[model samples]
Target: MKLTRHMMPLLVMIALLCCSLNGFAAHGEKKPEKKAILLVAFGTSDPEARKVFDRIDEQTRKAFSDVEIRWAFTSKMIRAKLAREGKVLDSPETAMARLMSDGYTHVAVLSLLSSARDMETVAGTLMKNIPGRKPEDAVIFMGHGTGHHPADAIYLAMNQVFQEIDSRAFVRTVEGNLRELDISEIPFERPTRF
Candidate 1:
């Protein structure tokens, strides 16, 4: 089953709750639970993009000051690219293994990107709240797509959902099957004259 962005925090909370309860159930004195948060990203080789990641890391550290924070990059290509420049980043698996070896009882992994449903909600809300938007005005959302991955279908699905939410709203991708979507296919209606 696919895990949604909205579910990540809930799952983390539940894991923490379970860990606390389990500690209480122990026969002897309670043991302190070691918890950590692992932020995973697709990663980019661009030095400028590293600033954004730094900001996220800073904010996460501030928010969870007591909990240990770590990072992992999911893209092997990006990791290798960085490695060539004498910088190394751990893969998600490697990061998790290290945390386990360090005796972290609970590790929460968080990643960017929302699930299809969450994307739909965001699109719908945006379409509804546009300033001075007319019925004939069209709103298009552009996204990056994995050219050949099965996940590319998410772009098409989101496009369909956007159109359903507002016939004038549409979605397009930069590098996917729907990248060449014809404008004529979009259901754009002309405003009616009184």
Candidate 2:
């Protein structure tokens, strides 16, 4: 019935603790879904190339308005060169690790590479290996292909490579399309294995 100054602080803290517990009980039953988009690129040291990268990044952010956007460069040499110029670049591995630590439940990666290179491999491996990364998650690589070059087949080959590993991963080109491959079926769910 009697309260002193020393007891007041203790009472207030106890009340706050009760409120916190109530808050947790009310909302902590279900975790909030955290989603992110990571745009991976080979990265360039040239200003013009950087401008193109920036434009692509901006467009991607616009398209994926809800999810948080991050960037990673797959080229170590380009990263080093940019670092010398006072620019920071996160590698694909680094970005994925950070996203996992940040509690993202779903991640969609869009890589701006012309062909299946080291970056594509890294993206595919990370998507497959990231703990708790689900079938709903997507990894897409965009390439610049030309009809005049035989190298355009690389994109189709990479797409097949992704399909074999996980259906959610896809590779496509701006100027190329494979008759056997359909872009409409991207972000596909994998068949359950018994």
Best candidate, lDDT-wise?
A: 1
Q: What is the TM-score of each candidate against the true structure?
A: 0.57, 0.45
Tell me the tens digit of each residue's lDDT in model 2 across 1-194.
75433353354345334433443554557546677887876577889868977887788789888889998876678889889889888876667667766766666666555445744675666565756555566666666654544546666777777777777767766675753345467643554221
Q: Which stretches of candidate 1 lie above 4 Å from their native place? A: 1-31, 115-144, 147-177, 185-194
Clashing pairs in 2: none
User: Cα-based RMSD of the predictions, in order?
Assistant: 7.7, 20.1
Clashing residue pairs, backbone N/CA/C < 3 A, model 1: none
